[model samples]
Target: MHVYSRRKRKAGVSDRGARVGKIERTTYALGWRIHTVATQGGLPLTYRVRQANVNDEIPTLKLLIEAVRLLHRAGLSIKLLIADAQYYWKDFFKLSRWLGIKPVIPARPQIKKTLINLRVKHGFIVEGDPELIRQYHRG
Candidate 1:
């Protein structure tokens, strides 16, 4: 069977552009995106790859649509898809549901209300390290 492949790439400065701590790389970074399809019985069928300096949401949606089209032609259309939350957006859910495919993705933790409200609702819970001296003093 003939399989199709597509590629896209994006480049940008790394958040940690050359420094210590969380920012440790003072350099450019390239992000990648890859999508693949296999038979209903789990056999390798086709694949594509794309890279982007930005986010994966839009690219992933585009690639998924193309893959669905190809799979339909091959009689192996996708049904249930498991993916990361990075690709979880309103449009992604809309398109996949429209295609009759169920997507299982965890909600992004950053959007958790309890976590977001911690500092504001009740001052941050700052815990101080316990030193051996403190334990000895208590004893």
Candidate 2:
């Protein structure tokens, strides 16, 4: 978010922390990168604020690791992590699986259409994750 202040320098905005990044979808402004992890019910679980110019994928890995650490320490487990397309990365998927969580992120917009086509050609789609399949059978 771009904070508009009349002052020559905003408080606490260092040369490294705050930089030029996109805001309002059409404008690039100086601000911090804000990333959030939320629940399926739209509740925020954790977040990170970093330099605005940082790449979208960098802080996400840290967020996921931190989330796993905090949740597991509290006697909870993350079965699935649903993120947006920007979070689609092979290494991220591998790390999430290693952490015992399934990453449900689309690689591209066409993935939805492809999956739909598969379901149309075949009556049902098979579940690849063993844990999810077992849960389906148990229910």
Candidate 3:
């Protein structure tokens, strides 16, 4: 997210959460990071805005937990969860499985070759591409 520094601040105020992060190789901007857990139709279930430099896993875990709890109260369970390769944390995925969610996170190239073809919904699944997953798990 790009934030235009348009507003003037108070005399003794500090830029608390505002931060600078690289937008591109040669470009940079001061802005916050937005983390959201939403449905397939793009309806946001939970969200958080934090400093750009903050680790995504922190708020991501919080958002997922919040969403899951809400859904559980409504008697619904998440069957499939699609996330970025950057979210491939062992402990995180373990917690997701304990909650009975099927997480589909792409394996990074560096670890793809080392990963086994486990079909467990609790652990990492190597096939992230929809086409590849479909090809292997034919219906």
Candidate 4:
């Protein structure tokens, strides 16, 4: 499981003339971090664990590469990778492509914005673009 971050409001003493107290903002962080890869049958083949302070993308990429190597040695090759947005990045996608593995990852908020811009530039709806749709769906 992955940890999610959320913003919270805290009560604080009022500083201005208003009767309502100031709202202090607080953010919560996940306590543990873990990345895993498994076979299509749901048999875990790789595991990477780190502290909460570690970023998810880097370790996940490393773990994937290692899994690929292990599978290759065992006369097996992966065809697809499924991951969350936290582990999604351009480099990861490129690496997966180079290794002949299709990656299925959700676009980050910024990536979604970029896609919107691309759609406008081409003057075509995303649904009408076969290649774009394939990439978006398969990637």
By lDDT, the best candidate is 3
- The sequence of per-residue lDDT tens digits that candidate 2 reaches over residues 23-90 is 65587766676687766676667788776777878888888888778888999888977664457667
What's the candidate order when arranged by decreasing lDDT?
3, 2, 4, 1
lDDT of 4 by residue, 1-139 (tens): 5443332347543322222211222533534455788876678899875555565676877888899999999999998776544555678878889899877655554454432222322332344245545555443
Q: Which residue pairs does candidate 2 place in steric collision? A: none
Q: Which rank order by TM-score, best down to worst?
A: 3, 2, 4, 1
Per-candidate TM-scores read 0.49, 0.63, 0.70, 0.59
Candidate 1, TM-score vs. the true structure? 0.49
User: Candidate 2 or 4, higher lDDT?
Assistant: 2
**Candidate 3's residue-wise lDDT over 66-93, tens digit each?**
9999888999877767665577777677
Q: Is candidate 2 or candidate 4 better by TM-score?
A: 2
Q: Residues 1-139, candidate 1, lDDT per residue (tens digit)?
A: 2122222336543533222211113733333334554444556455554443434564567767777888789786787655544465668878888999865543454544321111111232212223422321232
Model 4 lDDT at residue 68: 94
43 Cα displacement, candidate 3 (Å): 0.8
- Off by more than 4 A, model 1: 1-48, 112-139
Backbone collisions counted per model = 9, 0, 0, 0
lDDT of each: 0.48, 0.63, 0.66, 0.60
Against the true structure, candidate 2 has what lDDT? 0.63
Model 4, global lDDT: 0.60
